[model samples]
Target: MCLQIRDIKSKVIYCSAVLLAVMLGLGTRAYGDQLPHFVSVHFGDAIWAGMIYLAFRVLLTRHPLWLSLVLSLCFSFGIEFSQLYQADWIIHVRSTTAGGLVLGQGFLWIDLVRYTAGILFCYVIDQILQY
Candidate 1:
């Protein structure tokens, strides 16, 4: 049972990674041409979901679940807010086809809501997979 649980958890992590890649990739494709806010919302949720799966894999052994969750939340929010730096290098990257789509321009409150939605989706998915 333990091994099975671990395997399922690993699968969840793998799925999350794939989802993140797809989300970011799609975001990149849709970035410059007036995409909808839901695209950003999906991106934000993907971030939190990916982080939660990653945190479970990396920190579950050494930390409590709540701690890991808090850490994941912090990681998600930090990355979102950090984009405000608007560094020249970042701008240069964002100018590129790939960068412009994934690295969002300015912070939006809706993104925060997206992050929360993503975290909730993460838990829901994890629970479904755990069984």
Candidate 2:
């Protein structure tokens, strides 16, 4: 039987996780040149997905952790698939700094894997934190 994670998660801890993930994600992008190619290429997307999980945790405090994980996966996958649409407005949005960061310019199948791994990693972290 699975225990409900919502009862044990603290909003402050989730919020802090969100902030840390953001910093690490952004730092991965910013200092990517200095990092190993594998990490630079992979960790950014993973951290982004992890951050989304934490954000969902913070916002959906009453929801089960599995729900947050599902939603985070859906949200991350939705954003990745959205890159397939090349509308002028969206393309333009993806061209800017903020837009490019938020809405990636290109879609890669590997990103789906990264998101899954990252979310699952965070989910495990959340579970462990419950102790």
Candidate 2 segments exceeding 4 Å error: 1-9
Instruction: Indicate which candidate wins on lDDT.
Output: 2
lDDT of 1 by residue, 23-110 (tens): 6646645582565765643663555445554555454633444554566667667766867878899878877866644555667667
> How many clashes show up per model?
0, 0
- What is the total number of backbone clashes in candidate 1? 0
Residue-by-residue lDDT tens digits, candidate 2, 32-91: 999999999999999999999999998888778999999999999999999999999999
Worst 10 residues of 1 by lDDT: 57-66
Stretch of 10 with least lDDT, candidate 2: 1-10
Each model's lDDT comes to: 0.61, 0.91
Clashing pairs in 2: none
Which pairs of residues collide in model 1?
Answer: none
